[model samples]
Target chain A: MTTATAPAVDSVEKPGARERAKRPGTGVGRPGFAWAAPAAVFFGLFALVPLALVVVLSFTRWNGLGSPEFAGLENWSKLLDDPVMVKSLWLSLLLTVLGVLVQTPISILLGVWAAGHQRNRAVLSAIYFVPLLLSITAVSVLWRAVLDPNFGVPSQAKWLFGDGNLFGVQASALGVLVFVSTWQFTPLHTLLYQGAARAIPQVLYQAAQIDGAGRYRQFFHITLPQLRNTIITSTILMVVGGLTTFDTVLILTQGGPGTDTTNSAYYMYQKAFKSFDFGMASAIALLLVLVASLVSLVMVRLSGYDKMRSTMEGV
Target chain B: MALSLAACGGSAASSDGGSDTIHVLVYGDATNKVEKQLVDTFNKTSKVKAVLDTIPGADYQSKLQTVISGKQAPDLFFNWGGGSIKPYVDAGLLMPLDDFIAKNPDLKSNFLPSVFNTAVVDGKPYGVPMRGTQPVLLFSNKKALQKAGVTAPRTWAELLTTVKTLKAKGVTPIALGGGDKWPTQMWFQYIYDRVAGPELFQKAVDGDKQVWASEDSKKALGMLKELIDAGAFGTNYDSVKFTDGGSPALLATGKAAFELMGSWEYSTLQDAYPDFVKSDLGYGTFPTVEGGKGDPDNLAGNTNNFYSVLKSTEHPEAVAEFLKLMYSDQFVKDQLSIGNLPTTTNTPKFLDGSANPAYSTFQYDLVKKAPAFQLSWDQAFPPAATTTLHQAIQQFFNGQMGTDAFIAAMQNLPAA
Candidate 1:
């Protein structure tokens, strides 16, 4: 079947290429640079322009009241010297790593299980997806109420929550942030893995079963390896989303008790909006952009996701 | 691109001042109804019409800063006074109301002195008191106090005894919303005021960094430490918040005995637990600290919200006319009807007409006679310092920061 279709595809493509070459102005089956103009213009206007302005603003001193005055690396020097800034970066990284570690396994297992043709799985999956439907602000507010030490679930379950100081201490606050993110985002990742798991060819599993491979062995050998690209994609999304988390921190903890839960994104917002130090905030923002891009680039490189090689190449 | 952006800003600013109307920007909340009414009253007789614009409460400050220097600048804008308007004053964006006051002394004389002085910057008045004063008071659930076999404390010694009594009764002595951070800072403000008098903070905010390490400061910290060591606020105060109705619920449900909160607590409780407010809510001035330098009559919290004029307003006469309404009999009644205790001397005349007459009268009498009304430290310092101030406060209360470390943080705050 492959051999028969190979030449047929070549014949179809060759005539189309020749016809296009014969009448280039017709532009049939080909998109010109003009086709991308709108998107390019939009990106330049919204993303690149503001980014460039932020870079410039990072070198200045402005408190949102007047014209920015060029201060020549003052903001950068101060940011480097700021202990909270350093701490915030580590918190951001910690939350991101924890999110990836915790959410990956649960999403993978749930996705694979839901990929089965079972009514119960579908029902449970629908229920699990409820958190994804709520806005981040709503989710944070809801969790805050639920975790209130005196009036919330903690008071009723003292043995488990132990005073329900989830947002009072640094470790627990960080844990709450990671847990909330995982709870809110896992459904989207599970959906991704479900699609990927369903696409895993059934013949491979059938052959493995015929060879006396158990379900666990089949999952480890077949499903895990088949979902590599999807794992990489999901991880990259988690990495970026984790880095730029703002609303949750703002609503749940406000970067307290005493800056314990102050992540880089929240710190940037505090500087920009709360403190009204736009120049310093711009510096923090530019640093965030650089860090996010570098981390993603390294991830893509390490995973060989940029190579775009298919897992089913030999199938 | 930057130049074009600047040009756009310049043109926009010029266009805003081109009209005959004076725009009044206020923090949008329930009180905006009264502001709109005042504007309507001003527009009734004036040829130069008054326009009222509102930015939602949370975004008001940031929005004001962004537009205050540009074409979108309001002819007059609402502010919390003190450090809230300092940056604008420094930027020469605000009009000193001395000239307006020279023509209309009622703008200064009509409001309570303590409340009016909050808007004074650099020896010149910059704001007119508009909203009600919000002094921090010791609010208690009367039922909770009775259950604990204690009344509201009148002195530091009495407060400690009450804490002990309340704790022995298995009730948290104080319902502190430490998670909000600012609520934690309120304790510092009241303690510092009661122990060291308002001068220590005044000097501290006025660039005397040494005051944070002064003997009186240490004494105040020690007193606070004593209260904390006695577990006055219980163990999980840091996990509760006032904004989300956590600490208030604790008080209302009789799980805790007292909450040091702003005058707004009355309104907040009235909204959520009306029965509790009517029968059980009790309020009083902060307990006096024995042998302390501060006056017993000293107060701390938001003094009041003020309407400050922009330096570039085309119609100062119309703006002045608008400000005159702030102290008018109608303004006081409107403010009182909404449960706000306006600081106007005329406020006493309409006390009978207030939503809660007794509560309004109590607040008015306290504010009227107070020798010193210190604004909240966060508001007394510039906005940039608020984050550090709040963090230091939370850290100290939670024992995450030592006294010395907290003092260092305080000293590091950007000057007012």
Candidate 2:
């Protein structure tokens, strides 16, 4: 009764509490959606329309040089029997697993290192960011030289890839491909982690310190929990990125030494460009997109990304 | 961007009806200059202006596919004549040159029959042979062979001896660009024709599956496996690519002994090792297989590039006039000036005028006297089979797959 008596005097909603995104059409109304209309239109035209085209093209036998023949369910059924295609999907999945397992931890460690040594952060970041500056083609070419049996690290040292040169030998090709990719991409993920860590208020760490929390204790009780959302987002990014890894494999291996390193995206490219079978390529692509989307969704659900975001927004 | 798209649509008949601009698309390379010059020369005399478009070399085929299916298809375009034009032929998107050839008989009679016939699908002509013939030859370093105390091999037994002698002297016996699968295919194509003869491929092309799964095909693959097992190409052949100049660099550095390459190797050597070309670069035909029924003199390669007209062209008369230039004396001279051995009837006379007359004459005589000219398997098969055929060739060379697998792969290719 006391709270109700005070509320009738002034009824004004504060900013940022108008979370229209959470409960649509429930927030304060102002200007129309003209601001977002252009972006939505472009997203439909450039992204959504092309995606639809690919789905439609999957049902036909398109050589990309003539009229696409309507093959009904023939192309989709063929994917089941394509051993090379199936193997490529598996390889792509393997790369994703390795990327997440290796790249995520390294990025988090880098972020942690950057935080404690604030004076050297700029210098450290500059070093880590070097790989991110190089183009994928350049990175592939550089790594190819580094792994070359004739005059590379393997040539001098005999242990690394001398057992098998990166591209020529099956056992090392996939690993070398992953290594090259991780080497090139780790910096970007590290930057993301660093940015996320920086966003946390310093008072939280001070309060934890004042409670006699050690560094390890603070990291476990504060940093890791605070960085949960960042970790989930980075993991999702890395997973999806690994699924469509093409340039490194294309330049380094050409998916060769007999399909040992052909991932799903490269496999689709091969189907389209090398085989000129657009229908089959499109089918493979759609399947990969489905797997990628499903994986990201599952990861998000398991990490309670939506629930955390909603709880945080409710404040 | 929308304006350009509208322009493209408005000129959907850019080649067909309204526009006088007859679009001509060719693969972009060092050859684009010559193509442009030829078009300029044509444009000077003709009312129909030939607008040339050159797509980058790496993306040529894919871009060609896009343009052919899209609104910007050329009135006339450059192609490898065989499998490249087959799909368009089947689709009836191409204008058969029967009527055009009837008007200008030289389009058929001027070019080499086998070379000219590559563009002829299902007994009808669809294109005119434009560029020069590119027959595959076994190129050797004279110094390497001399140091190894061996001569250029002329038979399968001699090749094995050369390989043995070269390997013993610590030289890579063969400089194969296995990384670029087509170079590996040269070994298969020559071996297949040498062992099984051209009739087997011809029968396969004529829809006889028995030829692909035949004993002869298996034997050819067996010989290839033996070559691989013998360490003829050394341990790292798959890492070397011809297109990137890696294999050629190996040859230039004297790390490798011989390279089975095309007639273009002369120009490549000229570019890379001009002095070495004079002193060391020597080429010969693919050696004969022992007890093979195929003619030892039989040659295998790309016949030449061609200029095919689209049925969508507005000015057939103008395109026919331009095609006739493919056989013109001026065209022959221009082609010869660029180290091209044109496949025209007049090519023999113009040989002395070529950039490398000796090399040109040698290639000309080789093509002239060959009992049969087997079109390259990739060029002969449907475009869809190129990847499968190339993979099979590489797998066989690398010992990743054996004779049975190779035969099965070839057999599974989309039928000619």
Q: List the residue pairs that clash in candidate 1.
A: B13-B71
- Backbone clash numbers for all candidates listed: 1, 2
| Quality of candidate 2 docking, DockQ | 0.36
lDDT of 1 by residue, B1-416 (tens): 34434454342233354688988888889999998898888899999988888877787777677777776778888899999999999999999998988998888998899999999999999998889999999999999888767899999999999999999999999999998888888889999998989999999989999999999999999899899989999989888999889988888889999999999999999999999998999999899999999999999999999999988888888888888899888899999999998998888899999999999989988999999999999999999999888888888888988889988988889998
Give the top-scoring candidate (DockQ).
1
Over B296-401, each residue of candidate 2 has an lDDT whose tens digit, in order, gives 9999988888888888888889998888788888888988998888888889888889998888999998887877888888888877777777777777777778
Q: How well does candidate 1 match the true structure, expressed as C-alpha RMSD?
A: 4.4
lDDT of 2 by residue, A1-315 (tens): 334333322223444453543576444244346656788899988788878888988999988765678998898898989888889889999989988898988999898677665787788789879999999999888777665555457657766445333566676777788888889989988888888778766877899899999999988877777788888889888988999899988888888877777889988988888778999999999999898988888887898886766213312
lDDT of 1 by residue, A1-315 (tens): 344345435545675755655665543443446667889999998889889999999998988767889999999999999999999998888889999999999999999988999878888989989999999899999889988888788889999889788888888888888888888999999999999999999999999999999999999999999999999999999999999988889998889888888999999999998899989999999989888989999998999999978999778
Cα lDDT, all candidates: 0.89, 0.81
Misplaced by over 4 Å in model 1 are A1-31, B1-15
